[model samples]
Target chain A: MKLKQLFKLVLINIYHNKMRTFLTTLGVIVGTATIFLVVAIGKGGEAQVNEQYSKLNVGTIIIMPAQRGKVIDPLTKKDAELFQKSKNIAAAFPILNGSGDIKYNNYSDKSSYLGIMPQYQEASNLNLLGGRFLTEEDEKKKARNAVVGFELANVLTDGSPEDILEKTIDINRRKFEVVGVLKRMGDSGSRQSVDDSAFIPYSSAERYLLGTRANPVINAQATGLETVKGAIQDITNILNENHRLGGAEQFRIMDAGSRLASAQETARTMSLLLLSVAVVVLVVSGIGIMNVMFVTVKERTKEIGTLKAIGAKKKEILGQFLAESVVISLVGGILGVILGFANLPVLKYFQLPALPSLSGVLLGLFFSVTTGIFFGFYPAWQAAELNPIDALRYE
Target chain B: MGKESKCIIDARNIVKIYQNGAEELKVLDDVSVKVMKNDFIAILGPSGSGKSTLMNVLGCLDLPTSGQYFLDGIDILTAKEDQLAEIRNKKIGFVFQKFNLLPRLNAVQNVMLPLLYRGVEEEEAVRIAKEKLKMLGLGDRLNHRPNELSGGQQQRVAIARAIVGNPPLILADEPTGNLDSKSSMEAIKIFKELNQARNTIVLITHDTEVAEQMKRVVYIKDGRLFQN
Candidate 1:
């Protein structure tokens, strides 16, 4: 028989028994839809991770005092300068982090501050809202020049970037000139959030505001992503040599590469777990299809006999039942694709990320159809192997 | 030579045995029969007489335990299952007692089954089926499902289905068993007209009146055949 005619016959049979077909296909629909949704959610999580880490360079490494050790020798400007001389290291800077009160005329606000080198602006991806960043000349001359963050500028001057530019603010008890206001950068999976902090030259911070009370760390950049490990090794050699503590390491280095890798691994593991769930659902639904197909064969025993008596071969009868199951799953798969996409807006409304991929839809369809074929074969075979005399005589 | 050449069915010493663990029931015991082309014959038997088993063997639906049976010169015992199906498709037509019309299909589609199985194009099959149904006086009820049609109409549709493929032989099992007297008479008249048109037919029934109407009658009792 022509394939089209066979499908038409199968369709007519399915159409006449609408309730049974729908009930049999419901499990497939849910399974396919679950697969699609899982892929979309997985894609969304990957996108979110990429976006969160977008501002931080992968080669950037943070060096700090290890929490487990009491440091007799702290990271200093001289240590940073020595590390910058290495071939693998692109740039290195010493940073002193401290909290203090700032006074601008009568308005006062408190925030954490970072005393950093001139390269910190570029390395940290801090964009100046107005005016200019602290230059090498300011650092060399120990000029009390400060750069305030966006929110800090608003709190101090209650004005725009132009009004906050060049305003002198008192840090602790020393007067400092604000050279620039930084643009806003929201918090993410980074070592520090600089949104409301203040930046100043290290010389001025140590001399005027935080003398002898500073906690300093070194931040280093590698020339390329692949060179980060070499740069870390070089920095470790330089620091251990300078400290001269007989091989007892007192510092810890955290690289953005490991952080990014861990985050991506988390996302992949979550996707895999959900994918397993989808597979379980598909397998269960496949068993449901098998059960239903067996019942269908039993119910249509006389019909099979009648078809045989009218000269339908075993292959033709098998093809008919198999095509019926495949068509049912195909229909369910298409409906599932639509259902998955339709839930995208709902996911967005609930603040969940979803990115429906074409590959996801194709996989869903492939799995559902394969399930139909795999589960549908046994029952169709049973129908084909039925003896015509016995079937016709069956009540 | 001409008489042997015209034989459509030639069965000799056919035996069919059913086994139930240690017990064996011989359903057909040393039965033999022959049917010629264009010959109208009836195998008449009461219940448990095994006429249905004989019909099953004659129609190539069930193989005899031991026999040399030939239909249209094709060896029924030697043929494979698929070959028998193909032979049935090309050389035999069947009408069942219950009219056996698929309840979901309309009259025309039901009649189109045999032709469709012959790999005839759907349009040609439908055209032949419509001609057959129209000849059977179901011209206006082409779209009616079996449930919507009366018993006589359904049987007429079944008859149309049986002859649509223009097979050499028609094997009907109790074709009038579920019909009323008026419908049964009409069915017999249609069979007579079919035989007059040179179509061979073999009907199985218990009704003596129906068997008397045939050109030849064979009685089956206790799994044995007797011709009168």
Candidate 2:
């Protein structure tokens, strides 16, 4: 028979029993939807991690003093000078981190403190919500000024950045002037609480906070990510020469780029794991389709016999059943894609994060059609192989 | 008939055996018959008398265990299943007792099925099917499904389907078995008209009255043919 006539027959057959067709396609719908949702969620996590990683300067290397064995201490001015003298090191900043109690009028709270050189703001990529960041002149003059985080300033004074400027805050019994306020960084899994910290000049921190400590932790910036390893080696050699340490027993260097890479790798592994689970669901659903098709073949035996008696070729019979299976799966796949796409806006309406993309929809369609072809073949073949006499004899 | 005239079917020593465990039961034993073109012939018998088996073999629906059966001078007993289907499509049309019209198709669509199977274009198939239905006095029932039509109207639709492809031979197995007397007479009149119009037909029936309506009658008993 011509394919057009065969298609018309299949359509009429399916239309004759609409409820059974829909129920049989439901398995494909659920399977495809699961695949799309899982892929979208995986992409969502990847985007989140990539966004967090982008916040840091790529190829930046952090150098600090080694303590006990391999632990690094906060950066100090002496270490910064030693790194600056090295050839491969492009830029360096001495950093000191500590938690101290601050009191402004009757509002007293404990907040994180970061003491760093003026160049640290440029290297750290900090966004300023109000006032200005610390200047080079301010660092050179050993100015006892600080930049307050947005949340920290809110806790300290009941005013804006203009109102809180030059306000005195007692940090460990030493008073410092607030120069600027940093912007609000959104909440994520990263451990750094940029919202609750105060920034100060490194020189003043060394005088007041470091006391008799020899070396402080440092944040070093490289020209590019490719040069970060070389910069770390250069800084390590300089630090060893300055501190008079022996070979292989001196200081440790931490690369923020490597940490970001490991974080991305973990995210990729998790996404793959979730996708595997979704694949299992798709396979089980394919098996369900095969089972339903087998039942359909059994139920339609008399119909097949009648068709054969009317001079339909075996291939024509096979084509009809295969067309029915494909129609069921394709319809289900389309519905699943729509459902998956619709989920994004619904999630956004509820303020929940969701990622839906074209690739996910394509994957769902590919798997659904493949499942149809895979599961629809055997039953169609069996129907085609049916003996006309026996099938006609069947009640 | 002249020697140049075609004999639509010719069979010799046709035998069919069914295996039940170790015992083989014969369904058709050494039956030989010939049907000429445009002749209306009927095979009459009671239940289990092997008439249906003879019809099946004549319709090319089953191959005899041992026999030489020729349809349109082609040895159908040696033909493949697909080839047999092709021959059935091009040479024979069948009408079943149960009005085996597809419930989903309208009268016109069901009539168009054989032509469509023969690879006729849709427009031509529809035109031919409409002409056949109109000839069968079913012009008003073209769009009605099988369940929507009366018993006689449905049988007329089945007749239209059988004759629409213009196959040389028509096989009707108890064509009026499910209809009332009036409807059965109407079906029989249509069959007589078709046979008079030069269409070869084979009718299988247990009713002697139905068998007498045909020009020639053959009786079978206990899987063997009886000369009458």
Which candidate ranks first by lDDT, i.e. highest? 1
The clash count for each model shown is 0, 7
Point out the worst 10-residue segment of candidate 1 chain A by lDDT.
Answer: A186-195
Task: For residues A237-295, write the lDDT of model 2, one tens digit per residue.
Answer: 77666665343245568887887778778767876886777677767777877887798
TM-score of candidate 1 chain B vs. the reference: 0.97
For candidate 1, the docking band is: medium
lDDT of 2: 0.82
lDDT of 1 at A226: 89
Model 2 misplaced stretches (Cα beyond 4 Å): A49-55, A62-89, A96-114, A125-133, A144-199, A203-217, A222-254, A345-354, B1-4
Tens-place lDDT per residue, model 2, B1-228, is 684368888988999999999999999999998889888988999989999889889988899999899898999977998888788788888888877888889999999988877889999999999999999999999999999999999999989999998888999999989999999999999999999899999999999999998999999888888756
Interface RMSD of each: 0.7, 1.2
lDDT of 1 by residue, A140-193 (tens): 999989998888887888776458778788888788888988888776554556
In model 2, chain B matches the true chain B with a TM-score of 0.97
Q: Per-residue alpha-carbon lDDT of model 1 for B193-219, expressed as tens digits?
A: 999999999999999999999999999
Interface RMSD of 2: 1.2
List runs of model 1 lying over 4 Å from the truth. Answer: A45-56, A65-79, A85-88, A95-116, A124-133, A138-217, A223-227, A234-252, A346-353, B1-5
The residue-level lDDT of candidate 2 at A182 comes to 85
